[model samples]
Target chain A: MKAIVNVGLKQGVLDDQGKATHHALDTLGFKEIVKNVRIGKQIIIELNSSNEEEARTEVTKMCEKLLANTVIEDYNIEIVG
Target chain B: MKAIVNVGLKQGVLDDQGKATHHALDTLGFKEIVKNVRIGKQIIIELNSSNEEEARTEVTKMCEKLLANTVIEDYNIEIVG
Candidate 1:
């Protein structure tokens, strides 16, 4: 089975990388096209879980323990088997 | 309008970040649970495009010109507004 974990900064958190990229887009003349930009991380995991529920549980644990900093980030898990 | 640009390493390309994270997971005793792990980036853009097609075109151009490294990364766009 395969799973995708999408992690992003919590709303209202300052994202320096996103700010820099947004500025870059403006410098590149895409200012009028893009209003805002936020950057995040996606983690794709191929696992040996027996079922979707098992995968989701294990992946969620992983996220809570290691994959994300819960204080500043939020994560969503998508199972794609 | 809002759009999401998911950018990931092309298959067969070396992903040091992914490899490192995989190793970390193994160290964290998730080796049996996770077979493989690949890391990627997600860029969320809020824009003022007139329509979905327009948003798609502009976002694709942004990916090709700035958001992604086409030679080593592949990106998918999802408009959400």
Candidate 2:
């Protein structure tokens, strides 16, 4: 089995990387861009759990423990094959 | 309009972060994990283009120019209303 975890900063949080990209875009001729830009991280893990339920449980634990900075970020997981 | 850009190292590329996370997961009591792990980035951008087509074109350009490291990373974008 496999799990995909996406971790991202919450809305209203500052995203310096995103802001820099937005500025660069405008400089590069994209003038109609807006202000809210946020960046996140995705993690794809291939595991060998016995079942999807166990896999989801373990993956959820991983997300809470090591995959996400829960203080400022939120994470979601998708189980694939 | 908005676009989500997901940037990831191409398949078979070395992903140190993923490897580290895998090791950590195993150490943290997840014993049935496999070997291949990949880490990626997600960038969400909000723009004010006149239409979806224009937004897509501009967003694609941005992905090519600055959002993704074209040499090592592949990026895909999704527009969210």
Candidate 3:
């Protein structure tokens, strides 16, 4: 089984990295087409467990304990075959 | 329009961050269920253009020119409504 975890900042939180990237894009002549940019982390994990439910549960726990700072970020976990 | 770009290290490239995270997960008692981990970046962009084709084209340029380190990284762009 495999798990994909996407962790991103919540609304209202300032994203410094995103701001920098957006500024860079504007400087590169994309100012006319770009409105805003936000960045996050994508974690892909291969799990030993074959059960989808078990993999999702374990990945969620991992997110809470180590993968994310729950106060500032939100994460979504997807379990795949 | 919105674009979701996932940038990840190509196969065979060493991902130090993922390795560190995997190590931490093992230390936290996930050794039995966690097989491997790979980490990447997800960049979400809001575009001034509403057309999906136009948004995708501009965003792809952004990825190629600024968002992704094309030599070692691979990126996928998804245009969302």
**CA lDDT scores, all candidates in order:** 0.94, 0.82, 0.95
What are the clashing pairs of model 1?
none
Off by over 4 Å in 3: none
lDDT head-to-head 1 vs 3, winner: 3
What lDDT, from 0 to 1, does candidate 1 have?
0.94
Q: Which stretches of candidate 1 lie over 4 Å from their true place?
A: none
Better of 1 and 3 by DockQ: 3
Candidate 1 is scored at a TM of 0.97
Model 3, TM vs. native? 0.98
Model 3 per-residue lDDT tens digits across residues A1-81: 999999999999999999999999999999999899999999999999988888888999999999999999999998887
| Residue A18 displacement in candidate 3 (angstroms) | 0.3
Candidate 3 residues B1-81, lDDT tens each? 899999999999999999999999999999999999999999999988978988888888998999999999999999988
For each candidate, report its DockQ versus the true two-chain complex.
0.92, 0.76, 0.96
Tell me the deviation in Å of residue B4 in model 2.
1.1
lDDT per residue (tens digit) for residues A1-81 in model 2? 888888998777788887887777778877557555788999988878758888888888888888898888999888888
Clash counts for all predictions: 0, 0, 0
lDDT of 2 by residue, B1-81 (tens): 778889999877788998887788878877566556789999888887658887888789888878888888898888878
Fill in the DockQ of model 1. Answer: 0.92
Q: Identify the leading candidate in terms of TM-score.
A: 3
